[model samples]
Target: MSLVKKSLAKTASVVPSSTETHAPTAAIDVAQANAPVTENEQKEYPFFVAAIESDLAQLKTFTDIADKASYKSEALKRNDYLGYIKRYRLSGQNHHNTVLAWVFIWLVDLKRWDDVLELLPLMVEQKQPLPTVFNTKHWPAFVIDQLYDDANYYLSQSEQAGLFTISFVLHRLITTVKNQDWTGLEVVGGKLYAMAAKVDASLHNYGFAAAFAEQALAINEGAGVKGLLKDLQKLLKQSEPEQAVDAD
Candidate 1:
């Protein structure tokens, strides 16, 4: 068997059975019904699984930057399949839908941040299991790691423009994770706050940057934000006189 198939088998064991009751949620529009799976859905499910396997195999071979960029085009082609899975979830069908889980992961991989946010609540509510290749069992941790990595990449570019986008998405992600109380791997949540601080600092939002840095330190003393928080505080102090002069 290919590595992807092996990983899929491993992931299958962790997925909750269809008979399991979903965790209650009041925020997302997904229903809480026990609707039976349609015959058409049952018939079509295997094709989606096959497609995912094919895509995963192709994804494994993409090791270069140019090859990686193709993920956006590939991901777009899967949109129709994603829609079908979304409809299944909305109908209150809670089961081990690998198609739904993989498509969500692909959206994140493609940096389709807004689309990922739209689907995040329902994914958490259903307690979806990530593909084993990611090495983390919790989706929240995976998400934070992805955002932090992206933030660092943009920071390395020394361009403030990319940081602005990361800041916007990270803020919404942090809010969604907190509001939903989606607990994940240890210290991961603090990383999100620290990245938020870094991104905001790059964008020159000193006050907001300081606040996020402080929050990161509060969450994890070893979050490495102590120096960042100190710098932001100094920046804040420096800005105060300018604000006062402007007020005059």
Candidate 2:
């Protein structure tokens, strides 16, 4: 067997299946029965948590993006544990899974946009919490903040291609989080809308740009979109066909 299969087999022997249940013969047993995490999860959670902590500590040592990317590449090679955890969660089991959370964050950091999008809906459905290091209460807000920061970074570098790439993911994220309220939604969400507007404006898609800018302004007056909106409106007006004057 491969190393991953071997580790999984060993762990499986110790971890109880989700369907396994014990008759509560005492008060302690009753309390155990009511515990949120299954025996399987309790057994498996720590291994993944320890792995995530080690990865985070190692990641802190790298300053350059290339170094961090290389570290992530190496770390992802040992991520077979995630498959087991994902299966557990997808089987209607709900508990804090730091492994899944970190994987999502790392995927975002790596700019694996499609993978991130694929995982986002499941995370939202499971109501996954961000890791404590992020100090964010909700995952949706954290995602928007990350994407907004990415947009600004690309804009600062005058890298339109980067912005264009990020815009697609940003739009999908916005759609996913639409009507979802979280802490700092007005600020971060508004900024995201503003970023989308700016991107569309850069591409001369003035109509969509105006709409996004309006949404940003509506969400947060300080979203810094009023100037952009005015410019977009003027351009839209200039694009309108002038009236043909009849013979006087």
Candidate 3:
């Protein structure tokens, strides 16, 4: 027992009492670790908002359709439109600048069809929904909230969107025709011609329908489509002047 006690005391003495000791490992600072990289007050449009706004101000002065078209032409020649979209990140619909972006889409579809086409593939690549440049579900509803209380603004937008819609569809018709898509051409051509007969036997813009029919006939000159041509001609020969329909 004495020997065991001596051994224990020696062991205890051998453990240096003055050895340096370390504090326990500190716990991670969870709040600091999970903090956002960007501060809340930092500007979202820091890079090119000023430049974009300046360009947009110029567009705002282009209330005239012809003048606005000229601006679009000039911008496309210099590739200013594409740079604007990339710089402002205008491809998205959820940004703070959605209103501005959509307005840009409106003008582009009217006067910048090729640029609008240029954007379609990019939207597909980025997995973003196609912007309103191609498909607008309802024209007036689109502008009603934005152009509210100004009846003339609403009417002008509706009428202009209508004109643009027909022209845009015609553009598509020409594309499908060139691609030898008879079913597509037929489908598109049928809709326009049928729409002509809808309003009290009035051919609402059958001239474009006739244009599509002409293209379709040139592609497939079978007697099957001859009847359709005859029907369109009979309607065309009627005494009623063509009336334009607001693009729905």
The predicted structure with the larger TM-score, 1 or 2, is 1
Better-scoring candidate (lDDT), 1 or 3: 1
Question: Each candidate's lDDT (Cα)?
Answer: 0.73, 0.73, 0.40
Tens-digit lDDT string for candidate 2 (96-140):
677788888888887777777778877888888887777776666
Q: Considering only N, C-alpha and C atoms within 3 Å, which residue pairs clash in candidate 2?
A: none
TM-score, one value per model: 0.77, 0.75, 0.31
Model 3: residues with Cα > 4 Å off, grouped in runs: 1-46, 75-79, 84-110, 120-248
- Judge candidate 3 at residue 184 and give its lDDT: 30
lDDT by residue (tens digit), candidate 1, 1-248? 43233443554522222342573576544332445665555545565677677776777888985676586455445335554665476566777778888888877888888878888887878888887777887777777888889999999997777888899999898788875432344388678888899889888888888888887777778789899899889988888999999999
Q: Global lDDT for candidate 3?
A: 0.40
Task: Kindly provide the TM-score of model 1 when superposed on the true structure, using C-alpha atoms.
Answer: 0.77
Whole-model lDDT, candidate 2?
0.73
lDDT of 3 by residue, 1-248 (tens): 22222333454521112222662233433433344433311233322344344455778887787887676555433333343353233223234443234434554445344444444334334444324454533222222222222323323455555444444533542343343333534443333333322211222555555555555455445413455556667777673443333232
- Name the 10 consecutive residues with the lowest summed lDDT in model 2: 15-24
